[model samples]
Target: MAGSENSKCRGLRWALIGSVTLNLLVAGVIVGGFVAHDRHPPRPVVGDVSLGAFTEALSPEDRDALRRAAQKRVGDFRDMRQAARTDMTALIAALQADPWNRAEVEQILARHKARTIDRVDIGEALIFERLEEMTPEERRAFAERLLKGAQRFDKRLDRDDNRPPRP
Candidate 1:
């Protein structure tokens, strides 16, 4: 009976030792994690959910310069749009001339295609980058289709706009 008692005492001692060791290990990990976090708190990135960092990154002078540059770019784009409108007007006149000029029609189509590609490529790159689930080939095909569709739409509009106004 005493031998059995001794074995029971031994088992209880081992159990207590194991429980204390496990508790210490858990406590140590928690304390270590806290210390590490304090030592290396994450630095905020500019424009990453923190407007303060983004504002801080820009100097007042730089911001002013950026604003001016942005205005200039807008103006340049407006000029391009106006130029396109003028070309379209000339195209309409050429097509309406007593003898339809095939060369003028082709030239107008080419200019429209170039402008359409410029705008479409920007959208294509954005869509390709943002679509997380598409495979590379699928993304490429989608971008191609997008560009073609934009060009076709621009061509159709150009043709319709050039037609004579109803009396």
Candidate 2:
């Protein structure tokens, strides 16, 4: 009947309108989530270091000195890393070469091991030098800040059993 056809058309139109409205609502929600996420990014966690907290406790002058020290240390570290990479690459090639000599590989590995140890020692020495630059009071305060941060980090871990520990 003509009446039945009219009813069917009306129903289809309403269903289409409802679907369009829902899709627009969902799109709005998705856009909102993205905006919100961008505005409030997660904070970086660096183990128990609390580098930010330690820096906040320092005076402006101390902070400037610390920045300079960090820049120098980073530059040195990059140079060392590059050298290490080159050495490691050479070692890998030697190890992979056809008809490799065990004695030669062993010698190369021993030398590489010594070089790596030296690099670690130098890095630690740099860190120690920075520590020495700070006053005893500053060092004590930094220790306290590190402790509090660790406590806060542990409490966050307790909130969810299924979640793995954060670095």
Assess every candidate by TM-score. 0.32, 0.42
Give me the candidate number with maximum lDDT: 2
Error of 1 at 73 (Å): 4.5
lDDT of 2 by residue, 1-167 (tens): 99999999799668645644553565567568667987877532211221444545555665555556555556555675566556555655665679755576567557656766775665455446767888888788767776887787788878677687799
Model 2 lDDT-worst window of ten? 43-52
Candidate 1, 1-167: lDDT as tens digits: 99999999799668645644553565567568667887887532211111222223333543343344344445544665666666666666765688867578668657766776764553344333334445677456656756666677799999999999999
For candidate 1, the TM-score is: 0.32
Candidate 2 structure lDDT: 0.61
Give every collision pair in model 1: none
lDDT of each: 0.56, 0.61
RMSD of 2: 22.2
- For model 2 the local lDDT of residue 48 reads 21
Error of 2 at 136 (Å): 3.3
